[model samples]
Target: MKQLVRFFIIGMLVSGVLLYLISSLNQSQGYTGGNTLTIFNWGDYIDEELITQFEAETGIKIVYETFDSNEAMMTKIEQGGTSYDIAVPSEYMIDKMRQEDLLIPLDHDKLPNLKNIDERFLDLPFDPDNIYSVPYFWGTVGITYNAELLPDKTFTSWNDLWDPDLKNEIILIDGAREIIGMGLNSLGYSLNDTNKAHLQEAFDKLGTLTPNIKAIVGDENKLLMQNNEAAVAVLWSGDAADIMWENEAIDYVIPEEGSNLWFDNIVIPKTAKNIEAAHAFINFMLDAKVAAQNTEYVAYSTPNQAALQYMDPEMVADERFYPPPALTEKLEVYQNLGKRNLAYYNDLFLAFKMYGK
Candidate 1:
């Protein structure tokens, strides 16, 4: 009996050691010997499959996190708890980040596939040399309206939103710059116009829109428009496409007066610790197959000319979703105003939100 007990104890000890060894080995494989690359991006923004493939190809695990808005992302970075190796921000925010010297100048040699980008996107007012950012997706801001709800409305111009007929029928994006930009565009002023008189004009014009607006909201507006609860919603074109695809009554239109042309680009923050890994991940994203996959997943237009060949021919052919040259001429990309001007614009937005005309 004593010998049998001894054998049982020995077997248990061996099993315990084996389990510990297995656990440690797993911990090593799951974690990359501290070789993990952290990426911060918008929610539902990238094809997660790409992340898995990137890890498989580079053996560098990725720690991915998401933020809903540019403000939330920038706030988290400013708070300084986490160090993201790569972050995706829109063109205007890139200018803000660059002005603060928060971005690291990317090594273009490492991003050789950049030639895949449309030249029109390069050397813009924001990061003119393409020093700090790489194009991820590009699109326009426009109107998405439920045509069935207002059969009489032609909705060809931003002025239609101001039509007394739209009263209590519109749900505008709860974005300061976006709202103000719309007002500016409708009134024939530059969306990035810094002239005090021009901004005042926009503010006045927006005040007129305040009472007619059902609500100023973010993603919730998607549900509102999808349900046909609101006749109109001004939002990003990609979002409009998604919603329109689901509901036939809804249609997206860029008002004839024009609208904002925007791009979200991948950039490395100055605080980045995994610089080489960040470069690798970006290069992986730039791969033609990877870029096409991301475009389909996000349903946003890609700046990678090479990736288009891999996209659905019908989608690529649809001019409504992807603007043609003539439409491109009418779109205005946002530029970051100086600090005081930005503060003023924010204040104007807040004031308009608080007090209606």
Candidate 2:
């Protein structure tokens, strides 16, 4: 009898210990009584310190994930493999997601800090009334050239990239919309031109510049330009700013013929499981000081007007990155061309790449 009683007590004690450990594990994973906010964003796009700070202050855990392209991000979200509370996608992608009902309309009451965003960045065509997205960063696509390598040459327009002197010296960003848009803009056609004839004309024109195209690249374009491996590159303003900061000989220009103006915004995906925590995270990031710090770290143009007070005055005054309303209004924002049109653009750009090779 005594031996049986001892065995029962031992079993009860072990069960209580196991239950305690299980409860602790559940709390850590946010399964039972904790909050977790999952975020999908671009790689190296944010100041990670902010993530830690947010978690510390709000007691909400963060599950951060990154993607290299909008298409990749969209595919993963659509797959329903993981529930994402927030995603930062380009304006065009935001429109695409909205049309497909892959996003949830934002509740403004939870985003009082929305007032900090610049008026110019709000009410955009992609998310009218700021219902589905809020602007994170805005920048122009333009040329960044090593002035030391091309002492006498200046790139005032996209046509300059086709100059014989620049043969085999230019690197273009590897994006169908951007490169194709460049060809279109150079011909005085809309970057978002849907006219097949016009697009063909642009494609044929791009073929003529094949000799001047040394390589088509993505993020590595920044590294190549900084190392002076390429004399000229079609690059985004924020990336140009970063490269120029590292290389004194580098300079950026917005072509006279105009170019793309892109906006990346934050939104809630349809798979969001923690809506309240997501809103808290958004409002936390929109705070003036936080936004300023994030922009400084990422070297991107901030769309939070209130954050300007906390940023360097000189950086704010650089028109190339922070152009006045007049110049920005002249730049075209990418439209959400349907899949067919988008695929057509991609196909033409692929042909252009092959022609260059």
lDDT of 2 by residue, 1-357 (tens): 999999999999999999999989968676542488889999889999999999899989898899989999999999997889999999989988988789998899999999999998889777789999989999999999999999999888999998999988999999999999999999999899999999999999999999888999888999999999999999999889889989999999998888998998999999899999999999999999999999988988999999999999987998888877776766998887888999999999989889934
TM-score of 2: 0.88
| Regions more than 4 Å wrong, model 1 | 1-26
| Cα RMSDs, all models | 6.3, 6.0
- Candidate 1 residue-wise lDDT, 141-236, digit = tens: 888988899887777789889888888988888788888999899998878899999999999988988778898898898888888899999999
The clash count of every prediction, one per candidate, is 0, 0
TM-scores, each model vs. reference: 0.88, 0.88
- Candidate 1 has a TM-score of 0.88
Query: lDDT of candidate 1?
Result: 0.87
